[model samples]
Target: MVLGAVVLWELLAAFLERTMDESVYEYLDFVDATDSRIPRRSTRAPGLAKALSLLRGDGRALLFAGTVFLVGAAGSAGHNFLLWQLQDQGSSGLLMGLWVGLGPLAELALHPLRGQLLRALPGCGLELLSLAVLAAQLLSYSLLRAPWAALPVQALSGLSSGALRWRLQGTVGDVATPGSERALLALLGGLCAAGAGLGGLGGGFVLQRFGLALLLQASCAGLGLWILFVLIVRSRLPRRRKINYSRLLAAESSEMSDSEEENEDWLVKAMRDESFNRNWIQQHGIK
Candidate 1:
């Protein structure tokens, strides 16, 4: 199945490359603000130095990293033990497969509404929603004695994980300095990796010492902490004036069409125009 998926992805990528050359080039041009054909960091600094700068200078980036680390740790500790929990209840392979498969299906079902949700909710609201859903699922799993009881609960993971990732990516993008996105992403990835690794290693010992029920409860507590962190961070963010999302979308679409007709990308133009970027930040309330 994995191999087939890989093959399908390759085919689709090749087809897009072949048939949508101009559109692909336009997107590439938009992302490649430097137009050097190389996506180098604007600062041209070493990775370690850039990371240190973010830690020392960018409070929002630091807060984002800390929040993601806690999320990774809680996710790893709780999720890795889920299969074991089912097995302890004598779940069969078919039941386990159903439990796992339904999650991705639920996540896929939510994709069509993803843009609308993002437009409606603040970034912090999405994170809080993700945490709340995860906490509820963990609580349910902790209370369940029958394997079948846990099957429907698995879908919450799909929803929570999807929302969390979507909000996280947007938060990172908003906080990252122009042309420094790659470096910041690399750094965030490293922190999350470390957190996950530590969580997995520590979780086994915790399960042995505290048992499954306690471990699941602890996971819920961790998620609660994450919710608090998000709230605190949100409080610090600048307040955005209310704007009509539908109107904003229309204006952006019109701007895109006008820019395309002028042989320019809106983003590239924004990168060149200080006032444009400033107005954008002010309008969007991007701190």
Candidate 2:
């Protein structure tokens, strides 16, 4: 059923891609903006096809999807779990939403840095740096005494989310191409969405069982556990067989929110140039 619906949707999208008044490039731009991980492939057929390919390719596709799903699950577990606990921590509804929204807001401040980081470093290094940032955010939660202090933590969410969002696409794009890859990509994306939702639920339940402070303490513990998982599972993964840093970056750039993408474009351009990126990365030791 899942695969069938995707085929139907892909057929519909392909028909539209071919016949729509909008040119395919423009239509692709819409898709890139709407779901950056949708891949800038010339067509939507790959969303399903790639998954099929992955299955045929050493049985690695499903493993790749499942592995990332765990990471996504871990990520959602941390975020949703924390958000729920924070919301229940003696705050008003407005304050709760504002606080929860802070993670993306945090991204607003650090995206430039992340783009630079991705451009200069090995993929493992990028993953480590991103993980480090999230760990710091979790550390903040552990140390925070007042609810207001938690606002700063949300800023980290921006980086956390931005990194995950783009990396998710780049990862999917890296493995599943040939246009028909969209099925796998979309399914992976869908899993990420589902993982985050489940993470939220699990986080809330953990808090209910352990109480807020204990919940947070456990959350921190989980982040550490995830760090270990990254070291073991992520750091050791092979490089993308055909790593297109430029294309990978575009996959990421296209996914940025319109305003956010606009904000990041200058940075993207600067980083893409060899001289500019070298100096920039050197100044920050981004690698």
The best candidate by lDDT is 1
The alpha-carbon root-mean-square deviation between model 1 and the true structure, to one decimal in Å, is 16.2
Alpha carbon lDDT of residue 6, candidate 1? 100
RMSD of each: 16.2, 20.4
TM-score of each: 0.67, 0.56
Which segments of model 2 are wrong by more than 4 Å? 1-49, 55-67, 75-94, 233-287
Q: How many Å off is the CA of 120 in candidate 1?
A: 1.9
Report the lDDT tens digits of candidate 1 across residue range 70-145: 6677778656888888898899999998987888888888879889878888656776787788888878888988
Question: Candidate 2, residues 1-287: lDDT per residue as tens digits?
Answer: 99999999999999887676347545655766568655444544433554755656733344445544545655655555555555556766777778867666777767678667678764545545555666566667756666677776776676666776666666666666444345665677777677667766776686678755555555556656656765676545564476789998888777776669677897787667978778889999898
lDDT of each: 0.77, 0.63
Clash count list over all predictions: 0, 18
Candidate 2 lDDT for residue 184 = 62
